[model samples]
Target: MHNDCIFAIQLYFMQPVTGFSKLSKSQKIDWLVTNHLNDNATARETLTQYWNEDQKLQDLHDGFSENTVTNYYFPFGLAPNFKIDGQLVTIPMAIEESSVVAAASKAAKFWMDRGGFKTVIKGTKKVGQVHLMYHGLSSEMDAFYAFAKAELLQSLEQINASMKKRGGGIVSLDLIDKTKNLKGYYQLHATFETKDAMGANFINTTLEQLATTFRLKASQFDGFSSDVPEVIMSILSNYVPECVVNVSVSCKIDEIGTINGVTGKEFARKFVQAVDIATVEPYRAVTHNKGIMNGIDAVVIATGNDFRAVEAGVHAYAARDGQYRSLTKARVENDTFIFEADFPLALGTVGGLTSLHPLSKLALQILENPSAEHLMKVTAVAGLAQNFAALHSLVTTGIQAGHMKMHLVNMLEQIGATDVEKDLLRKEYADKTPSFSALRESLLVLRS
Candidate 1:
């Protein structure tokens, strides 16, 4: 009896509570505050402060995920005057980075009269895999594939019916041999065209069904009646090399004109040299790609697409030649300064949070309700423009000059400056470099 009581006590401490996942949203929050937080009342107040005031809207947000935590917000801003393929597009970007929107807007304006950005959608193919293990002979494995290929395609007819109506579904299936890498290992590789959806769930569901059908059919096939292939797992691949978009901005070297005290010819030459360094140096390429993602991810989040997937595919594409290199390329030919980026981006326009989240819906509307292809083009242009702007600053007045100027506002806020004090400091730092420590010391001197 004593031992039983001790065991129960140990279990209670090891596991916080029973049926935590099944708890009501309010009950979960109550439990969290009561047990986890240092100050329960203050925690409760802070959490509730972030909630939407409208009851219906709060409920909608609560349904987005488990635990019903308070919303975390980012600044949603617009970079106007982006002309892509001769059409003007004002991009919506949701990000916490201070200078991304400003940089993108500046790039757009710089190129608006210099022939803007151009984009092309190369392909739109997503992928999934069904892993399997077969200890049988190679001949048997080949025979099994021959038999299973037809059955797998026939089995998914019902599943593919609706997708087919929308001009998408399974595009092709292949049996991949991996016996050299891992003993008794194989994969059923499948490619899909999901149209306007990101299609992770769809691809996963289809792969699972295919695995099931393969196992059932193998039990009845002559070669596998006794030893059937072991079903390992099924999943969707985020590294979508087939789904690619290319964006480029080009202008005559003389048309680059002058900006930030750098002549057009000097700027173009330095820009191409910078890109060449990134192409050869891994250390520089990572930062170069990160700058591009700053623009890509912002638009991806605002439009409710999966930014992580886009990031994975883009980075993989960058390293496709076995060396990690810059996604953006720049060159000069016949007095034309050309900057271009070709990367895989499997984004969606009509599914997931696009239909659910209020801001996502508004973001799509702001883009004028683009199709999946159009969204791909817009996202690519944003990335290319951001890289161009960053390089432009780097080759001219240096990055920190303008960046720190914008960052001065954040530093002032951090130092508890009032509107009048901030106005005074802005004038004081107008011609000087701004730093947090310097700003704080200046504010103290002024107050004293």
Candidate 2:
């Protein structure tokens, strides 16, 4: 217990500084390991190279597989002060984006001043779908679903021996009849609690075997081609998945007011209005969702889950309402701003890169083997923070006010401008309308 406490404290203080270039490789690695549990010397040594990996990274000419290249995870940090339902929690995120981490952290701090975040995580259940297309079986759809459910359960008992031992088995089968459409498709949704694992890979393998076994059992004399010809896709469906995590944050208006002239209530109302833009417009929602993912993807990679899978599911879920919109809802009521975000989080406790990645294993240790529900809880908080940061920036100043200035310095330096020359250009471009010719002339004047 003492060691765990010490490690936890160490994790809090080991947060990376804002300006990353100042830190030595060893220092960065130490920070990564202390906070994330997944840092190593190799990651530290190649940190700069990793930053450039997206570009200059060439195809592996020799023996390395495509998986090797795509699987290299980037860890970014989001440190936010938060009190979740009076329980103080510091969120450490690993993402790769310009403003995502900062935005989320700021948002967390804002909500902490009120009453903090409150979350309720449902059971970590995943749904895998088995779709079969039958050609000449207009009347067989009903019978086929019934037989498939029993066979699927039996297969679940055989293959998911571990789940059964742990008192978890295939719970039920939900049949979706979309026969009015082309080819008359049948979707069998297998719902089950996976205990700890994400269960996609395991479930996929099980479903594939079950589909073949069930077809054979239905018609033992010959192949069941005419009746149930082929299985279109026997895998997981991100649609209406059972795995969900719901999180909400409530804080008084006074908690949001930092400006001397502005009351907290007024600030909260303005912030609410800013977030509403994302809810109403798809254009704003895209970037808004991206900011949320910035924090999510980092943790996903750090924990060795399938980030791409989660991303695909989230965007699709966003459009599920017929109109593309925000995944989160925010409002200012009474003296408090209430925020809630819920999404399909099909994260597993084991398998995939979770076992393969060295850093992912270490990061998981930092969270103390959090359940899927707990992980989703953290993700919800992070998303809230990200949304807060974005709205705060846009509402107060403007999108590019700070970011553009920083980028300009980088641009000036890249163009061989000395510190003195860069300073001159920054002053000249403060209006943000400097011509290339004017910049070139200024550079010449500075050199002289």
lDDT of each: 0.90, 0.67
lDDT of 2: 0.67
Cα miss at 336, model 1 (Å)? Answer: 1.0
Model 2 stretches with alpha carbons more than 4 Å out: 1-75, 78-80, 167-169, 221-226, 258-262, 405-413, 416-448
Tens-place lDDT per residue, model 2, 266-356, is 6677777766888889998898888778777777766777788888887887898787788888887776678778777777657766765
Tens-place lDDT per residue, model 1, 349-384, is: 887898899999999999999888899999998999
Count of backbone collisions in candidate 1 = 0
Model 1 lDDT-worst window of ten:
7-16
In model 1, the runs with Cα more than 4 Å from the true position are 1-15, 24-26, 224-226
Model 1 lDDT on a 0 to 1 scale? 0.90
